[model samples]
Target: MKVEGIAAIVTGGASGLGLATAQALAGAGAKVALVDLNEQGAKAAAEPLGGIGIGCDVSDAASAEAAVARAAEAHGPARILINCAGVATPGRIVGKNGPLDLSVYSRVIAINLIGTFNMMRLVAAAAQSLDPLDGGERGVIVSTASVAAYEGQVGQAAYASSKAGIVGLTLPAAREFAPVGIRVCAIAPGIFETPMLLGLPQDVQDSLGRSVPFPSRLGKPEEYADLVMSIIRNPMLNGETIRLDGAIRMQPR
Candidate 1:
């Protein structure tokens, strides 16, 4: 919906795409709650928007529950929940040293995949209890996947698997939530200009940008936010994973 005066919670809201989405929601007059592991950073980023920030570890059930509870207490149960908290730690299953550390892969799965589900369940439960809005829509959930889910390069075994899980989750979630007037969708972004990618050398960043077929530049975080707004507005777009990549099917490195 319109977002105006509605409650929203954006995970990973301290920086990058999460922060961008939170800024967009706040600008559109949503009562925004910014959640991140860095509580101070989240608080600082949310200050100018007149929003609240909460500290949370999305992978932990207790932490996520407490965060959602606090947000609901402060702004009523949220109708818009955006899942942007993720990690992209690159690793190979079989490396030169040896088999990849199980912990490495586990960490990625726990935070990127399980963490998303943890937040989604909590937010959706709250949303389902609220009275339906116009068109029988109670809420919208837009999660952040990655192009790597489809075309993972050589060094992204763990990261790719985690994102692929998100892709697989979207449809089933949508189908399950349909009766409750909730919509579920995901965005599979390519090489966006997120904080992690921007930390690379300038030439590396430029090279990565040029890999796109057209509009040969990195995708902006705001563009991701724009797509999220579109998904929230258009009720027909559910159970789908829209690729925000500019026709960039990655090659094996």
Candidate 2:
């Protein structure tokens, strides 16, 4: 569907992948809404883009509902929903300190997995009521996953499981939304230069970059944004999780 003049909602829009996507969508003439926990940051990011920002906790039902409603009020029903809000707190199921806290696992799942679904469901519900666009498409949803979903390392039990749930949700959602002209897809990024990765030592970051087979560098946020645009433009791409990794199959660390 054409992005120009349509409303788009991006979760985690304060920073990282979500911020990059909000900028891209705004550049394409879409009315962008940045939904994030950092209200100030979201407003700051959305200002130059000429869009609105809302503070939202995606894991909470009421917060997410209110956020989506606020975006619709300002920009109309969202035609594009990008699920980029996630956390990567790594810990083993049974760590040196003994079993990990149950809340820790629940937190990861709540924010990463449940949060994606919360935003998707609410956005799609609104999008379906709108008239179809070019190819009988009412809306499109792009969710974020990780290569860890496939090959999780030692300490990434919770993170991997959360991402795996996203991967799992893509197809069923697409199939269900098909009749409504709403598409669902996902991206499993390998190692990107997100704030979390950048916080590591320089040498460690470089090592991670060198692990990619061909590009031999970390994935750029713009590159991911580019793929999102491609998915939005291509009508046949649905119910699939494309890997944005540069041919990197993560080892079992």
Prediction 2 global C-alpha lDDT: 0.95
Error of 2 at 207 (Å): 0.5
**Candidate 1 least-lDDT 10 residues:** 86-95
lDDT of every predicted structure (CA atoms) = 0.95, 0.95
Reference-based lDDT, residue 120, model 1: 95
Report the lDDT tens digits of candidate 1 across residue range 113-170. 9999999999999999999999999999999999999999898999999999999999
Clashes of each: 0, 0
Task: Provide the TM-score for each candidate, comma-separated.
Answer: 0.99, 0.99
Count residue pairs with overlapping backbones in model 2: 0
Clashing pairs in 2: none
Q: Could you tell me which residue pairs clash in candidate 1? A: none
Backbone-clash count (model 1): 0
TM-score of candidate 1 against the unseen true structure = 0.99
* lDDT digits (tens) for residues 1-253 of candidate 2: 8889999999999999999999999999999999999999999999999999999999999999999999999999999999999999989899899999999999999999999999999999999999988779999999999999999999999999999999999999999999999999999998998989999999999999999997999999999999999999899999999999999998999
